[model samples]
Target: SADYQKILKDGGFVISMSGKGNCYDNAMVETVFKTLKAEIIWRTIFLSRLEAEIAIGRYIDGFYNPVRRHSALGYRSPCDFEAAA
Candidate 1:
């Protein structure tokens, strides 16, 4: 624990932690990973790491962030929500 704290302090990184035994703090990230796996990862077989990287980058940039609607953001895509903000 001290090592982790020291490393964060040295790196000037802010640590965000959930309360002990509370999983809700990471729910949003977990949901995104689950969606990615279901929608993109599970559907394709990558021939190379580079291809996978590019495909994933395209999926996130061309589709997910700009096109996919998120119910948590009142059914708006992230780009829409950000522009509105």
Candidate 2:
């Protein structure tokens, strides 16, 4: 919607380069979702939305950001890559 576009623009966030349903602009995000599902989501059953949120937060903060290595980051975790930069 135009209002959403305006909100994003006002926040200095760029909208997708392509139209909806086009995955080219968000391939990396899609990959992350896939991995998140495979690694944390599919294996766990959450009793509530808050539980899921907490689990995801821990997965990203305690492990993914600080420990999981990525090939794009030369096999270093995001925290390590950012520090090296």
* Runs in model 1 lying further than 4 Å from the true structure: 1-13, 19-22
On TM-score, the candidate that comes out on top is 2
Per residue, candidate 1 scores C-alpha lDDT tens digits across 55-82 of: 9999999999999999999999999999
Where does candidate 2 clash, by residue pair?
none
Model 2 misplaced stretches (Cα beyond 4 Å): none
What tens-digit string does per-residue lDDT give for candidate 2 at 37-73?
9999999999999999999999999999999999989
Best by lDDT: 1
Question: TM-score of every model?
Answer: 0.81, 0.86
- The number of clashing residue pairs in each candidate reads 0, 0
